[model samples]
Target: MLATTIYEQGDHRWIMFGRDPDKAEGIIDTNQYLVISGEEAILLDPGGIELFAPMLSAVLKYVPADQIRYLFASHQDPDIISSLGLWDQALPNASLYSPWLWEGFIRHFGMERIRYCAIPDEGLNLTVGRIQLQFVPAHYLHSSGNFHVYDPKAKILMSGDVGAALEPGEPPLWVENMSQHSAHMKTFHQRWMPSNEAKDHWLRRVRQLDIDIMAPQHGRLFKQAHVDEFFNWFEQLSVGIALR
Candidate 1:
C-alpha cells in the first residue's frame, strides 16, 4: 500500500511515505525523508526502489528534482541505497552525504552516477541556507558503517532502525506507548546488536544528546515524553537487565 503523510512541526515540514509498517521483518519497507531548508532540499534514506516515484512526486510538490542539493543515507542498506542510482541520474548536480566508511560501498554500486561526500566518524556538517546538520555517530547499531543524524534546529534524531516499531498496516507515525514500542525495539537491538561492548558504547553516546524527537525509520516519531521513557527502557534492555 502507498501510505504517505505530511507533517509541519514548528519551522520545518516533513513528507513521510513508505510501505505498511507491520510488514517489517527482514524487509526494507523503511520510510524515506525529505528535509527542506531555506537554501536546499534533501532526501534522506531514499531506498526501496518502488517508493522512489512517490518520494519524488511528493518532493515535486515542494521543489524541482534538480533543486535537491543532497541525499543523506544513515547507512548502506539496499532499501537505503538501491534507488540512489535513480536519484543520481535525476539530480545530476546533487551530491550524496554519508559516513566515510560507506564511500566504498556507494562506489561498489557504481560511482559514475553521483558524487559522494563522505562524512567522518564524529559526523559532518551541511549547510542549507542557514540551517546546519550534525551527523551523530551510532557505530554498529545495525551495521559497522552506520551513523545517526541530529538536526539541533529541529531537535530531531533520524536514528536509522535502532528505535523501530513494526505494526502490520498503517502504523502510527509516532508511537505513544513506550512499553509496546519497547518490545519491538528490544528484539531489533538484541538480534542486530550482537556485541555487548559496542551496544553499550552506542547507548552511552546516544544518551549524551539532548533530544526532543527520536524519529526511527520503522515506527512512530517518539516525541519528548516517549523519548525519555523509551530511552530509559532501552538503556535497561541494552545492559541485559531485561529479557524477552
Candidate 2:
C-alpha cells in the first residue's frame, strides 16, 4: 500500500500520498483532496480505481467514508475522477459536487448514480459549519472547465496542477526544499500552459487572491512568504525563465 502524510493548518487538512514520484513524461501523480465543512466533508479528485483503497484508508484517518457528504473535481480528467464510481458504491449517500461543465464525462463513470451540480458563473461558496469555501477560476491554466478551490478561513488554496511538480519520492510534501521543488515547478509551467498569453493571464489573476498555504496537486505545500515567492517565480517562468 502507498503511504500518505497528513498535512494540516488549523481546520484545513489534506492527506497526500504517492502515485508517480517522477511524474513520468506526460504522466502525473494523481492527488486527492478533502475540504471539511462542519460535520460534512467535500472531497476533491477521487483518482483511479486502484487508488480507492489507499485513498479511502487515508481519508478515514480524519473522517469516515460515510461521513463524506460531497465530492468535487476540478475537471473530468480520467486521473481526477475515475475512482468516483468507487466512492459512489462505497458511500451511497455522499453527493458529488463537480464543475457542471464536465457533468456528462463524470456521469459516464458514475452512470446514473452520479448526481452533479454545475459550476456557477459567480463561483460557489460551501459552508460546513464554521469553515467556508470559495471556488476560483483557473480559466486557461490547465483546461477550460478546470478551476481551483480556496478556503478564505484557512488561507489555503487547493490548486489542481496549477503549481504541480514531478516530485517523486519527496518527503513531507511541504515546500521543505523550495530550490529543488522550484526546478520541477518551472518544468511543469513550461508544459502545462498552452500559450504565453494564457500563462500571463493566469499569473496576473492569481496574484489578486490572498494566499497563505498553496496546496498543489503535486510536490510540497507552500505556506506564507514562500507562497508569495512562488507567484513571483511563476511570473518569471511564464515569461520563459529557465528553472533547472
Candidate 3:
C-alpha cells in the first residue's frame, strides 16, 4: 500500500492510501483517506477485511491508534467499511459516522466498541479539534444514502464514489488530462450511478463549494482545473443508460 500526503497546512493534513501493488488479484482497487486536525484524526472508507492489516499499519505511521477519533463511511458498501470489526478493536472509543439509513445494516459488520454517529438525510457539520467538516448529502449518486465530506480549510471534497474510475494496476495519483480521464470514469458512472436527477442534484450542490481537489474512492484525484472539468463533464453525462 502507498501512503501519500495529498494536502498539508498548519495542523491539518490529508493523506491518501492506495495503489497497493500486492493487493489481491480479483479485488477492486480502493483508496482510503485519513484526515488529521491537531491531535484528532478520522479515517474515510477504511476498506475491506483483506486490507485491514496493511491499512492499519500504514495509518499508524502518521497517527497513533488512539488518535483516530472517528471513522467515516460514505455508505454501507463492504469495500467502504468492512474493516469495522478490526477498527472496533483498534480504536475502542472512536465513533463511526455514516448515513442514518444504513446504521442497522452496517452494524452487522461489527460494533462492539465504536459508537455510531448517524448522519441525517440533509447531512451535518462535524468538528474535529478546530477544523469543521461538512457532511454533504449525495444521495442516490449510487447509494440510497450517500454523503461526501467537504473540508473548507483544505478545499477538498472527499467525493466517495461520485468520481470513481476503473483502471488496471497502479495509476498516477492525480488526473492530468480531462479527455483521457473521462474514458476511465464514463462507463462506471453510467452503470453504477443510477439516477440522472440525483446526479444533477449532487453536481449542483458540489458546484456551490470552493473545491480545490475532488478525491474519489477508486480513481485518480482531480485538482483545481481538472475538478471543474470533471464537474462540467459529469453534469452533461447521461447516467442510468445501461438498461437502454
Candidate 4:
C-alpha cells in the first residue's frame, strides 16, 4: 500500500496508507492513518492481518517502529484492527487505545505484549509528544462502542466509519463534488449505521468542532466545503429507514 502524506505542519503529520493496486480480492479496501508529532507517532486503525506487512513497511518509511508509541482502534472490526497481533510483535512497547466496552472482545486480536488503554464512554484526551488528540464519542454509528479521533490543531476528524463510502475501485483521495459523492455514501450510511438517534447525536457534536477535514477509515476524505456538506446530508438522511 502507498502511504501518502495528507497533512503536515511543523512536527505534526498525518499520513494515509491506501490505494493499493495489489490488494487481495474479497478483502475490503481500508485506509490506515499515521499521526506524527515530533518523535512520537500513533497508528489509527492499522488494518487487517493481510495488510500488516505493507502497512508496517509504509509506516517505517516515515517513522521507526519504536516511534509508534500508540495505536488507536476506532472500533473492533476486522478491517479496523485485526492486525493487532502483528502490531503487538512489531511495536512491543506501544499502547493500544480503544473503547472500554470492547476491551475484552478486541483483546482476542492480541494484547499480551502491548498495554491496552481503555477509553471511557465519554472519551478522553491522548497526548503524543506535543499534540493532544481528542477521542470523541461516536456510539452506535455502526459499532456499539465507537469513537473518532479529533485533532484540534489540525481540525481533522479521523471519523471511523461515520463518513465511509464503498467504491468498486480506487477513487480519488478527496471529494471534489458533494452531490456526486453522496451516492457513494448514502446506501452505506442507511444500511450499516443502524440508528438515526445516534447519527443525529454524533452530527450535533461534530458541528460544534472546527473541522477542516473529515477522514473515514474506508473511502475518500472530505475537506472544507464537502465537510459541511456531509454534515448537512447526514443530518437529514433517516438512518435505518430501510428497516421500516
Which candidate number would show the highest lDDT if scored against the true structure?
3
Instruction: State the lDDT at 54 in candidate 4.
Output: 90
lDDT of 3 by residue, 152-211 (tens): 999999999988999766689999899998999999999999999999999889999999
Model 1 lDDT tens row, 181-237: 676667666676656676778778777778877778776678878877876776666
Model 4 spans > 4 angstroms off: none
Models 1 onward score TM values of 0.87, 0.83, 0.99, 0.98
Question: How many steric overlaps does candidate 1 have?
Answer: 7
**What are the candidates' C-alpha RMSDs?**
3.4, 3.9, 0.7, 0.9
Tens-digit per-residue lDDT, 70-109, candidate 4: 9999899999999999998999999999999999999999
Residue pairs with backbone atoms closer than 3 Å in model 2 (clashes): 21-168, 37-128, 38-128, 100-118, 100-119, 173-220
Worst 10 residues of 1 by lDDT: 1-10
User: Arrange candidates by lDDT, highest first: which order?
Assistant: 3, 4, 1, 2
Candidates in descending TM-score order:
3, 4, 1, 2
Error of 1 at 112 (Å): 1.8
Return the lDDT, model 1, position 10: 47
Model 2 weakest 10-residue run by lDDT: 16-25
Worst 10 residues of 3 by lDDT: 167-176
Tens digits of per-residue lDDT, candidate 2, 105-124, equal 78888645545767864468
> Which residue pairs come into collision in candidate 3?
none
As a TM-score, model 3 comes out at 0.99
The 0-to-1 C-alpha lDDT of every candidate, in the order given, reads 0.72, 0.70, 0.94, 0.92
